[model samples]
Target: MLSDPSRKYRPFPQVNLPDRQWPSRTITQAPRWLSTDLRDGNQALIDPMGAEKKQRFFDLLVKVGIKEIEVGFPSAGATEFDFISGLVRTGRVPDDVMVQVLTQSRKDLIDTSFESLRGARAAIVHLYNAVSPAWRQIVFNMTMPEIKQIAIEGAKLLRDNAAAQPDTDWHFEYSPETFSTAELDFSLEVCSAVMDILKPTPDHPIIFNLPATVEAAMPNIYADQIEYFGRNIPNRDSVIISLHTHNDRGTGVAATELGLLAGADRVEGCLFGNGERTGNVDLVTVALNMYTQGLSPGLDFSDIDEVIKTVEYCNQLPVHPRHPYAGELVFTAFSGSHQDAIKKGFAAQAQRNDELWQVPYLPIDPADLGQSYEAVIRVNSQSGKGGVAWVLEQDHGLKLPKKMQANFSSTVQELSDSTGRELTSTDIWESFEKRYHLKGDGRFRLIDFQESQSPKQQDERIFAGKIRIDGVEQSVSGRGNGLISSLANALESALGGQLDIIDYSEHAIGHGTDARAAAYVECRVGDGPVLFGVGISRDVATASVRAILSAANGA
Candidate 1:
């Protein structure tokens, strides 16, 4: 039974047709999901998922509607085994849910792995051994016939182990490790022999998971392989055909979907494709693919934020900010054209859901992943009139004049690319006031000023400020309700401009009493007398000086 190490022998050599494109027509329905984040993900960790984190993640997996979760390789170590024990003991596992444990076909490992499922409602004992010719020669150091013998022996051991745990309904799953690269006939023979000895019933059907351990070829080759096995494998009607693929070639999801079309009934993966080397296929991406087509993912991952957070924390890996569905800025639009298109797309979609079908602006709604519409538009260098005006209307309740919107759009873009960051709503105000209203030369400026308040004076809150304008220095005076307004009025007289303070506020500069006070004002424009300018400063006199100059220049 020695496998052909040459790998040159062809199994139905002619593949005849080219591989189908992604977003395949054959990939219509979602398959049964099996999350191996705990088992497969754990093994890949430099600091493996500890007992507490593993147990918590286990509960989260089940609660998220993953009916069949590969808990861990119980036989690998005591921590995984103990973690499994705690999972079963808590009685938190749903009746319909199945706790799956992985082990090699070796007798000692199989026995130890089964010990973790003493009282499970129903469970799968997953066992495997290397089956490819290269694995036989290099890794296992066994001949093909020796691999067959081991496969048979492993099946018997798994059968015996399940029989001992008959009190809890048990099922079995066997994988021909790296079956994608193995000789077709050899894989079928071993899997057939194992199934015959195991005899999986309809109530507890066995699963034959063929893993493309390394993505050596395109998805179409994998599809042809699945189609061949599904068509030729004996009693496959009583067994489930499953797929476990990696992302080494960046087609793990593609391979998985086509494998299903070729007759795979289940998929095994991690949440965000976390695994060794390239990583396992991402279940979230595949599941949401189904959602986009209006099909149920079967698992309740509607609140994907919580799931992303939990996985990010458990793996101690940060989710990439641009990662689809779970990224911080996946739906954010910084380009003005993009924002305009997205906004219009949303408006059209709002009137009717079907109208926005296939809008070029967005492939998925941000809200679907619990992101807000606000995140959909960000003001920056590439931002446009629609995006900037949108921010103004939303944040400041100020409607941008049509001409003003046009003028500010270019300036906003310039400021954004210059800053190289997301511009806040406040930045928009500063941009407008600086470019237009505050373009005046600083011939006159506030030097120093301080004021003391006596609450006993009804409308006589005393205000004092100093000004040095056009080589002339002056001390000004005014009577107003507050320090900020009094400072503005006195400075307007010294500079000879009409002062109308629309809004006034102060902010603490630092932690303690020595912290300087900053002030801001919306003052009436003096030249055109048709607009307003915003002024800000740490010193009240400086604020008034700038506000008057801003209005004079703007006027």
Candidate 2:
């Protein structure tokens, strides 16, 4: 039913190298991370961040342990210039962190950028120029030689500017802006020319950032381009390969990951993947991906909720609820089967006491990022018995037996189906109390009771109580092994019905002196169907007795 567009577009050519090495490579360590939230992410906003918000975001980046950050494009305007100048003047730029400023390949913009960075302890002067065939032919209407010369002249200007600022330590970075779509040989030529002008050594390395400016091709193509450049570019030992991927294709994270495998040494991205168009690759996801692999990403996302709040406040945009790791419902499971498996996984984890996280359906432990188990299993029409039991056990400390769980699950599912919505933990508990725990006027109700153990029959216990049936009070007595059994015997004799206990479970439901015990009982009367009931009281014995009466009333 879909229109084919094969005639309109050609497939992107694969790398010519038959022995591609990136496919077998793995990321074993953390790369140098550079956050461009203030520059790239801010620029993408409809209402760009103000000075206060920019400052707050910058501090958050530092707190997240990023040693290098592209703070702003100083030549863009007054606000950009002022934010950079303020960081320099106020000594806000930490000594250990390097603040980077973006600039075009123009001499004037490079000059203004240096002026904004003056008095800073250290900074990276990031210079970029468009170098793709499409850009060269359409935007500049120039040849490859002319475009290469522009980058060389920009490198010369950067050198002169850094020389002028003798008081600050300066590092250099260059990006072939449309490297993803640029010819491999041409991209290499331009980058090599800049490196030749910069004369960078191992101790004083230059960062050659390759940006997927528009993401014209698939992610694997970008990885091939990066690998080819890393393998062929001259003075490779003196250069640091970096990736700056965009999400136009919605595979920026995958592209960056593959690119990293292709020998890239650094990453340039924004938190939550904020950038122009489809946005940049999400650094949080990429870094945390490393964290889950047992590699220390060297970033602190322990309090991810705080991170989300700060980002949302500054960006004035709510993060998607399904966003990886940071979303409100990322750890939640609504499917019946998934919830059942997760419930069993948690139980297994508790007993195993193993340090490694192996919960079903959850890739990483939610607790590792400050999330709790309370929201892991949510109840809806689609949920099953395990999810209902998990909610009660985790949130309200009521561990229902297997049969009782099935009973409560049906109650929850019917409520959710009737309401056509999901149920919260509170909703589940409210439904449970109404259906099972509520005292009702029924066939029989227990009055005050007495229990005694006979010395002659050590195992037998005698129970006697006043019962009100059909508005009349009657004295009843029966003997059995336990309070619940004796009470059931007395009730069966008076009501003339067979009493059979199917299942039972009990647990403490609160804390301290105010704590109460909750008991669940499943029973059948004569040939009647099975019924479930619950009771709560200060004493476990009383709670069990109440559960029997509740079940009888329901029957």
Could you report the Cα RMSD, in angstroms, for every candidate shown?
13.4, 12.4
TM-score on alpha carbons, each prediction: 0.66, 0.68
- The segments of candidate 2 whose C-alpha lies over 4 angstroms from its true place after superposition are 375-555
Off by over 4 Å in 1: 1-25, 353-358, 376-555
lDDT of 2 by residue, 137-167 (tens): 9999999999999999999999999898888
Estimate the lDDT of model 2.
0.85
lDDT of each residue in 1-555, candidate 1, tens digit only: 448755764442534335533225456676888999999987887668777568667877987789899989887778888888888988867887888998887899988988888888888889898889889988879988899888889999988887777788888899999998888789998989898898877666889999998888888788888878777788767889889999888999899888887878999999889998889988988887777778778877766666765665456565566666766677777899988887887777778846445544557666776666585322221235655665555444444444446666788879968987556557877887566544444454556666667568876566665666665678776667766556656666554675675554444445455544433344563553443333455554565446544544444
Highest lDDT scorer: 2
RMSD of 1: 13.4
